[model samples]
Target: MLVVQPRSRTVVVLAAGEGKRMKSDLPKVLHPLLGRTLVGHVLAAASAAAAEQTLVVVGHRAEQVTAHLSEIAPAALPVLQAEQHGTGHAVRLAMAAAPDATGTVVVLNGDVPLLRPETVAELIAAHESAGAAATVLTAEVADPTGLGRIVRDAVGGLERIVEERDASTEQRRIREINAGIYAFDAVRLRDALGKLTTDNDQGEEYLTDAVGLLAAAGAPVGVHVADDVTETLGCNDRVELARLRRLLADRVNEGWMRAGVSILDPATTWIDVTVDVGRDAVIDQNTQLRGATTVGAGASVGPDVTLIDTSVGPAATVLRSHAVRARVGAGASVGPYAYLRPDADLAERAKVGTFVEVKNSQLGAGAKVPHLSYVGDATIGARANIGAATIFVNYDGVRKSRTTVGEAAFVGCDSSLIAPVEIGAGAYVGAGSAVTKDVPPGALAVTRASQRVVEGWVQSRRAGTPAAEAARRAAADGEAAHHHDASGTVPGDTATD
Candidate 1:
């Protein structure tokens, strides 16, 4: 017996709108929400739904959108729409790119960042089950303002979709609104799109008209009602975009919490969809974890921290710090106020204490840089200790260099280890020293002027002042004490030594 294989799926994203309401030089679809561009979220859902191919229609600063797509979704092809026609025209351009598309063709609006993959999957299931020529995703909203209303027939079948501008008072009263997501039979969609014309109130080719056209021609049209109305929300401006962000953040945080991650304050903590949190991790308040960041199991991050493209190993603790493109090994601790720039790597059991800044440096296991210090372009070996106020002077006038601290080295407080130098294993660097040359193994390196005493200088230089008066009285008391000692008697002549 022979078995048949499933049909292929194609996703078409309509992103050509100029989005004048956004009021920014960047393309509307390129605007970021929850650490991802609006269109990027839609593409993610499409990919999750297992689309064999994805086509994004771009216009109005197409170059910028295409460039961003290359970085985020390289596999998804982009097709340019030279003119701002309408949703129908945008889909037409996408179809032109995939003229041989078969099976299910899903259409998604680029601005609906809250759309979920399960909803798209449900829409496809409903369309295939009903053998529908076209199916529109619908939701029952509290207020249907600025949206298209779903009109039903006597038997509760989809009759038509009426835009807000074209809807009558009775049609506007309908609570079921169109979500601008659809699944269609490829052949039927191609025919219906070719039949569309600019006859609507906006004098543009409206995609909703295809639903009415198919229903009128006796083609089976269906409706898939989404369980959650929030999934259908779209943004036209920054205010709506922020609302979407809050909703998305809540969703993301809840998922992590359910998976055993502890979020102290969900309201103040923002986790991007791209971020991964291992089980049993703790995320404190006022923290934003963004852009491919990963936290290993048993990690503790922040009461106030932001990590971007960074990795926190298991059992590590990062507090009140900011890190980007860095890595912290297991059992390491970073900051009450630390900044780890790109290429900063900490080995296991390492410590980067308060007010420290590290850039392009590597700390070996058990190495520590405590208190106020700056370590740049340096490598610290295992068991080495860097004292307070120590700075690795890595850059000179015309060039930058690196400093290396050997294993078990001890750097004293208030020291500056100039780059192009090396402190050998077991070497000791004295306090207030400025090391300019390499030190041999087990040797001591100290650079400072010899001590010099300048007694009574303040008394002679600042006469008739507080210092001079205090010095004069101290000298008189010393002279009297000396006489009393010689006589072996007290000042009051009561007792002898």
Candidate 2:
């Protein structure tokens, strides 16, 4: 068991390659994997290992990479590799910029996002215990094609690393491959890097050359084989990027499942690495929790939901909703179909029901906007009820205003509350009304056209030629029947006589 102090180590991430195979203008290291850039994940691993300082070498699209690093990991120092050379050149630039020059230096590839921090720690531990000038992280993959092979001595010590193009027939048969990660003694690594040459087949200074150089100088070079070969996988194109994203997503979901979060369908649920979910929260199928979302205990989300930077309080239920930068309080209920935009906050036991869209508004405790409504830039007080098809018209042509519904206010169906108006506490708004003015407390507000009745209108329109003739015939028949009855004669019986 070997331990390396965090303060005695520096990490150098090689990210200067121009990933031309990706067929896009964005730098390969900037390509996103599972909601985070490729290099961002590598930086996270370095941080997790508690390195004293991490240096990132940037070349292609240096400005973009540097800008992103500032946002995510500002503590990390960014060094520019002005030349688009090999990995060796990138590491040299990073090492030059690193503050702890006498400490151990661990070099990692930025495109390998799945490499675990624990593995990095293990590599450093091996390097320290063996007292080796260089320790390479190796993996035994099924396929050795297009990868550098690790050549070991007869005594099973790492002798040298040979790239696929330079390897002999027998050397290519070796299954163990270099994973492009190394832990090196700072002083010895600097010496080897100084003597590196571009005389190889590729005519580029190779990092693997340093490993051989250290070995040739009678310095012990150790090899640490990775347990999981997939961790060594690197993204070169869009296809590989997708593969890595899926693998990382699976890893994140499995961790949550083990921590008491119920994911009904792991395959259909996508959660970002930055998301936090409390125990007993059930995430249903087709849910994507992205960008710093936090779900409290006993919360039920999805069946079809996408929440970005949203917070769900304990015991809240959000179903079939899309929310961004919203907050649903404890015991609140939202959606079978709802959209909650930025700054929309729902208080405890509040309900935003089907077909409702809330933006930049607050729904107080026990308030209900049940269906077919849009509440924007407004506030609904406690116990307020906004009826179906109601809309708070908060936007005029040039500017946006707000509407306030006081506590216990009742807004009727199909009504519009024009902006800059307030409905007082316990106020009643009639159905089909378009309210434009504020109403006093406990007052009834109705702004609809008065109704006017037209008496005998149907009869006047029906007094036509055919209608009058029919009425005259009916009157004659009735009089004849009355005469027969007064004479005590049955009209139908008189025919028999």
Candidate 3:
């Protein structure tokens, strides 16, 4: 159901928790799940609610966390809490930032990234309709032992909330738990925040205590128990983070699997936040598609490959390859150990064989790099045959260089095209040649070392040998003489044989 739209609602994200358990210099909210920040989910939830603005409350490692959030461009303000007092104290710091606020203020947890927009809207609507001073978002947990329990009044109205540390044995029986999310009348929230005291057991001002104070003052305090606890799960540790991510992955994978993409192992395949898999695309086990990577329709990604910031066109096959910042066109095949670095482009039907590395190069349609080769800073034209072990010697002592091969050019096995070199269309580079200059069309460039032999070398050794050894050496010398004479060729001319 569409909830009542508020005149204005400012979402206050509480990311100030020390999160000491994370054990990292980076803020807890910065931990990535499938290539997106944990706090991004909270911002996304607020956006889904059509929030007028979102405000993030930051404290520990606030600067680093805020810097990262700046990249996402959330529709919210950032409220800094300098002191590590408490949750209430954290939200209180936001008062000066949103002073004279009269509409709804939806308080959210920055580490809880699984929130849904619908639930947030409901929280705001519940507060507005009832004109409540404060409304807490609650969920029924099977075991609400560690969480704060929502203590409802006899008439099932909001009475007070007690933290587990301060709760009595009787109060602990309440299965309904506080999710730490709230929507309050901005004016009343501002007023109540000032009156709050740090009299709790932890010597911290508890936000839940305000509910009791509001209720006792005859002001309305509301409650909105969300249907699913999973949406409210807060990630403070690695285990919960993984659990929440698996939950999220299941949702994302199921949607794609239903949409005709094939995931061989849902448990093993991981996809990033912005990746898109086309129809009938098959993603095998342990494959990770991250950072805006797109697999086109009918394309097959590895049972074990990592693709980052790359695009694979339809029917392309990338098997066991690490492709980063590259583009693989339609029907291209990248191999079991191919590495395509930044700016590499494999055009339609191009083949990159095992152990080959291409960096900042463009392989045109039907071009083949078969086996151990390095093509860096080069351009290869259509139907070019890159024989085994070919290396585009692109880097000199100071600056990197480029090599260009034209259409139908053949680079023979073990050949090196030293850059600033170009092979004209239909040109050939003979085996084992290192071509440093351009080769004209239809020409073959052969760079071979001279061959020389010392005649009667074995006969010379016979002078120091015994009689039998000399005889044995004579037989081997006859065979060696039969195999060669001059020009490194035997004198068995076909008709002269």
Best by lDDT: 1
Question: Please, what are the lDDT tens digits per residue for candidate 1 over residues 1-497?
Answer: 11212568889998888788989998889999887999999988776547788999999899999999999999989999999777888888899999888988999999999998777777888888789999999999999999999999999999999999999999999999999999988888888889999977888888898888899898999999999899999999889989999999999999999999999999999999999999999999999999989999999999999999999999999999999999999989999999999999999989999999999999999999988999999999998999999999999989999999999999999999999999999899999899999999899998988999899898878999988999999999999999989997776664453
The Cα local distance difference test for each model comes to: 0.92, 0.91, 0.86
* Residue-level lDDT tens digits of model 3 in 220-320: 88889898798888887888888988988887788889999999999988888679999999999999899989999999999789999999999999999
Task: Please provide TM-scores, in order, for all candidate models, with all chains considered together.
Answer: 0.94, 0.90, 0.88
Residue-level lDDT for 76 in candidate 1: 88
From the highest lDDT down, the ranking of the candidates is 1, 2, 3
The reply for model 1, stretches above 4 Å from the true place, is 1-6, 462-497
> Please, what are the lDDT tens digits per residue for candidate 2 over residues 1-497?
23446657888998888899999999999997776899988887776457778889988899999999999999988899888668787787777776357767899999999988878888988888788899999999999898999999888988899999989999999999999999999999888888999987888779999999999888989999998898899989999898998899899999999999999999999999889999999999999999989999999999999999999999999999999999999999999999999999999999999999999999999999999999999999999999999999998999999999999999999999999999999999999899999989899999889999985444477676677667667778989999989999876685558
Quality of model 1 by C-alpha lDDT: 0.92
Error of 2 at 419 (Å): 1.3
Model 2 deviation from the true structure expressed as Cα RMSD, one decimal place: 6.6
Error of 1 at 384 (Å): 0.5
Candidate 2 to truth, TM: 0.90
- In candidate 3, how many Å is residue 366 off? 2.0
Worst ten in a row by lDDT for model 3:
456-465
